[model samples]
Each structure stands twice: as structure tokens, then as C-alpha cells.
Target: MTAHVVQRSTAETTLMRQFETEKLSSSPRRADAFGRFIAGGLPTRRVESWHYTDLRAAMRDAAPLAPAPDSGAIEDARAILTDRKRMAAWRIVLVDGRLVAELCDQFPPAVSFSREEPSPVDVDDPMVALNEAMSVEAYVLKVADGARVEGLIEITHISTAKDARSVYSRVAILLGIGASASLIESYLGAGPGVQRNSLAILTLAEGARAKHVVLVEDDAELHIESRLGQLAAGAELNDFVLISGGALTRRQLFHKLIGPEAKITLGGLTLLDGKRRSDTTLQVVHAAEAGTSREYYRAIVDDEAVGTFQGKVIVENAAQKTDGAMKSQAVLLSPRAQMNAKPELEILADDVVCGHGATVGSLDPEQLFYMMTRSLDRDEAESMLLEAFGEEAIRRIEDDVLAEALRRPFWAWLARERVARVGGEGEIHWVESAS
Candidate 1:
């Protein structure tokens, strides 16, 4: 018998060595996950799910794994979080992907926290498997049964190192039966080549309710955030995400309904400028009877930026009377801007209502002109229109202050730059030339 050995890339070799040095290879779970990753390799454009992002090509060389932030980096994070401190009662901080116990507030009686390894899923995705293999520690958060918490629980992730690096973080949240809470996940950092991978697993017991919000702030680069969740009978989730900056950002979500009368509402808003690229992909499964799901996503792209949204809803034969709908809309602010939307519905059930729709277009000239005629300057009108468009989705958020905070970065960009800069198409002119 002959044995064949596959070759590994420079980054893969470095990571394998790091894994051994860190003694991660000693764990059977991590070893198995790494094996799966080695077999699948990195996802490329050939894979339909990754056709647009092309992560394998985006990352030509693997970066060194980010380590625990030093004292200097901790202070940097504290300064960066000054404004956000008011947004939540308790904040969980992760610097360079390592948890900072001193910065995190004491948990309430309804909540408990622990650290352990994340459970590997059945999927054969390289990113997922890599996260499992690379993750050094995972946070476990549990809510007491029937406990209703009023304040917000915020998880803040910051990367302060200047060198090219990568970090993996894992989080698991369990909502006990009839428990309720508000959770926020915020990602913020600055670097040209820093890469981050995060995996989150959420489980909602019967009658549990949760509102999950994700905020991707400015200066982030090469970020991948994936979420997987299961909902039990009468479970309800109001989930939302707002992305304002990143060189390359990908948000992937998968949600499954395991019991009857499960309801979920999903919304997303992305703002891209310069040459940034952002992709939001999601799938919802209706495996039980009387499940309901709704998804609405919107994006604004400027300059040479690119934005994409891919959403899918599947209704199984056993999921009778299931209701699902998804819609994606984008507005291009420059001629060179690009937006791609793919929304799909799959139904193997006879009695179900499901539909999906997508739209991509430029700002309405007529609407802008009308606003100008009403005494508003062209730039002011444009800003107002953009804010109004974004506010639609923000209005649906469960937290009023959080929604307002999410809008600041978008407006800040508009205020700082020339809104009428010449670009691929629909270029705005600041002054009329004497002809």
C-alpha cells in the first residue's frame, strides 16, 4: 500500500507549528478539526457559497496568530471604548482575541460564565474547522431559566497589534426556558492586514426571547464572523447587524427552527466607502410547523467599494404553515460602486408561504432635486436621504440608544468627505463652471 501526503502552504505550515508549540494538537477535538480543515483547504471562488468573496485569494499569506494584548494594548482598548462605555451595563472585553477579566464587569445573578473548548459542527467548511482548531479558549454564557434581565450585555473585541496577525474567538450563549436578554457584539480595530475569525453558537430554550445586535466599526480589516443558532418552541429572536467599515468583511449566519411557533426577525445595514468589500450571507431553516422568519437587508456603497447580500430560506415538508420572506436592497453612491444581491426560497412543503426579492439602484435624482427645491442644499439633501434610508432599518432595533450610536459613523464620513466627488457614475458637482 502506498500513502499520499498533501503539500501545505506557508501559512498552513506556520499555523501547524504554532498549534503544536501551543500544545493544541494534544487535544483530540482540535486535532480532528484540523484534519477536516486540511482536507477541505481554504474556500475559493469555485465554491458557490464563496463565489463572490474568494477568501483563498484574498489572503495570499497567512498572518501570525495574535496573542494576548499587553498592558499598552489594554490601555489603547480602554481609550477606544470610552464612547461605548455608556451603551451597556456590563461589558466583556477581548483584546487580540484573548479575554480580559479585569475589564469585564461582574455578571448578574441570572447569568453565569465559564471557559471551555467549542463544539465542532458537522459542516466541512474550512473557516469553521480552522476556528475550532485555532481557538485557544471559548466563552460560555448561560441565562437562568425564566430570568428576565433588563440591562444590556456587550462583548467588545479589539485588535491593537500593528504586525500582520490573525485571531480566533469562540462564544456560546444559552438562553434557558422563558429567559430574556439583550446582547451586543461589537468589533473594532485598526490595521492593514489583521485577520479575525469568530464563531458564535446560540441556543434558545422554549419560550426564550433574545435580541442580538452586531456592530462592525471603522478600521477593521479581513474579518469573518459566523453565527449558528437553534430555536425551540415559542422562541423569538430579533437579530440585527450594522457594518460601516472593513477592508474585507464577511458575515455568515445559519438558524434552524426545531420546535413549533418559533419566530425570528433579521435585519442588516452596511455602509461601504473607498475600496472596502463586505458580504452578508444567511440561511434560515423551517423544520417545524408554524415557524415564521423575516429578513430585510440594505447597503450603501461609495467610490470603488463592493457590497453583496445572499439570503436563503428553506421550508421542509414537515413544516406546514411556515411563513418566510427575505428582501435585499442596495444604493450605489458612485459610478464605480458595485452591489450584488442573491435571495432564494426553497420549499419542500405543500402548505407554506415563502418569497425572496432583491433590488440594486442609484439614488433617485428626482428625489434629490425635489429636496433641493425645498430649500435644502444638494449635499445636505443627499445626506438627509442617506440617513433616512438607513434609519428605516435602525428604527426596528430594540435599543433606541444603540440605533443612534450605529448611525454616527455613517454621518461622520458624510460630514468629513466631499459628498459630490466625481466617480464612476452619478458624480455630483460642487460648483457650476462658467460655460
Candidate 2:
């Protein structure tokens, strides 16, 4: 008795022939999340949490799904959302992945917006069951109960496909009980053979509070984002992610502090250069008792880029006095850059107090020779010590205008890394700053 087959690539056989010519795959929860993504197919490097971004060897094929926007792609996504500038105060657009109701904006009266249908996710992740089986529709966004909504609530996911395509999106964010909110999840225009699959679901409830900011500037040639969170009793959440575009990226976060004393603060920043590759994976679960968590991440790899940070902190057994902390830092600016950090901790009660840490080096050659002996050069002292090491994870955002709108794209990706190091090394260019 031998039988071991499972080979399937070509982007998992074009995602199983686009999930059998989708019509939301005849429902039943998108045919049981496309039969659990055809029994686990695209997540490689032997899937130990996708071992530093393998994604079926960087998705070898699959790009032809995005369609549904024309009226000249919604007037070119309404002229790029009316020439940008309005970082938030309620704005909700989404183009290639649907939800573009007259280009969105007008939510108050305790906030509300709907679209429904793609929920049910218990997460055994096969890219969240292939984005709940090729997405189709799910844009929720609710607030209500004890609402205090003030400024930010962005939610812009553009991607106006200009060539090879594939995009699937789903979003759901709800906060009720003693609700408070602030959120921005912007992933802009597609370029360079686009392919994106994104999913976001967050629920808060009891004494709810949330502040989330994620901006992955799209240069998609394969980008995957999955975030799921649930917090309840005394809920609070603060999450921040800023990855400067993709050429192959992976960002996944799963959080759950299900009840008593729930709190979380997770931060991230990854900005890699050419030959790009970025990955940030995190998981936190304190299931109950005195729960609290904090995870911070930072990375800045350069030419021949690659960056990854994997973090996990779990404390079950009735989460006794659980409190956790995790940190990851990286800097490598060349010599064929690369950074991989793994931080983990799993404690089963016994009055928990978890911890984790990781660091990868380079940049700080005696603080760049004391700022090049005080008159800086060498690319302005390595872009002022990599913008103070990516502004220490955007100063753990306690809203200084959302930490300067995530520091104007971390100072425009350090002014495009000093105009790609004074326009040399493989002649890179792109100098558009000022946010």
C-alpha cells in the first residue's frame, strides 16, 4: 500500500481552476472553505508557519481573477481617490476587490457599512482557507454600542490592476460594548504583475477599544495579508503594521485574548529593498484570566532583500496572570541583505509572564562613525541610523496623529533609501517624498 501524491503547484493548479469557476462555489460556506483549500496546498518550506515565506515557491502561476471595476476602472479609482490627501475621518473604498460604493465616504451615526457573506473562519489557515474560498464579498464595518468614534477609520484597498492580475478581499471589523475606534488599512495601487489575497476580521465587544493602522504600499507581485483578532472582557487592541510594498510579501497575525483583562499591542515595520521579500508572522493567544500582550517588530534589509520575523506567545490553561512581551529587530543594509528572526513563548498557566526576543545586526559602525565625525555623509549617516531604527516601531503608536501617519511612510521609506544610495548600485530611482 503506497499512495503519497500531493504535488500541485502552478499556483495550486490555478487555485483549483479558480475554485471551479466560482459562483461563490455554491456556498455552504464557500464549499467548506474550498474544502480547506483543497486540503492544504500552497504554503511551503514545509509550512512550519510557512518557514520564512515560501508560499508555494513564490506563487508560480495563478494571476487572472480581478475583474469588476471598469467605468474606466472606476475613473481610475476616482483619480486615485481624488489625489489622495485626507488620511482619514471616515473613508472606505476598495476597488479591484469590490466594495466601491460611489467611491465611499459618509459613515457616522455610529458608523455602519455592509456587504456581508464571507464570515465563518475558525482558522486552520491555508491562507485562511484560501481567503474563505476566493472571497466574493465581505466588507462589514460596524460600531454602535457605546460608540466614541472621532477621527480615523480609513479602509482603502485599491489595486487597479495594470497587467497580470488576481485579487480577493474580505474585511470585517466590529466593536460594540463600550466601543471606541480608530483604524486605517490602506494598501494602494497594484504594479509589477499583481496578485493579492487579503483578509481582515476583528471583533471587540466588552469595554471595547481599538486602534489599528496597516499600510502596505502595493507594488504587488504577490502579497498576502491575513489578520484575525478577537478580544472581549475589558477589551483593548492596538496594532500597527507598515511594510513598504511587495514583490513577494507575507503578513499574518492571529490574536485572541478571549475575555478577562484582554489587551494587546502589536507593532511592525518592514522595509526591504530590491529583490524584495518581506514576511511578518505573529500569533498571540492568552485565552482568559489576566491577559495582556505586547509584540514589537522592525526590519530594514537592503539590496537582494529579504526580511522575516516570526513571533508567538501563548498562555492557556486558563491563562492565569498572563502578561507577555516579544521583540524583534533587524537592520542589514547590504552585503546581500537578509534577516530572519523567530521569537516564541508558550506557557500553560502557573501564573504566566511570558517573554521573547530576537535581533539581527548591521548599521551602527560606532553609530556610523559618530555620524561620520559630526557632519554626516555616507548616505547621511546611514539615513540617520535608519531613521532612528524605524522610529522604534513608530513609537508604539499612542496616536500622535496616528504616530505621524505611520511617520509619513517611515519618512518615505527613508527618502527611497537616500535615492537608492545616490543613484548607483543597479541604478535605482524614485524620489517622491512628502508623504
Best-matching candidate per lDDT? 2
Tens-digit lDDT track for model 1 on 130-155?
A: 88988888988899999998888888
lDDT tens digits, residues 15-108, model 2?
A: 8888888676877777788787778788778889889888887788889889888888888888987876788988888887788888888888
TM-scores vs. true structure, each candidate = 0.92, 0.33
Q: For candidate 2, give the lDDT of residue 292.
A: 87
Kindly give the number of clashing pairs for every candidate: 2, 0
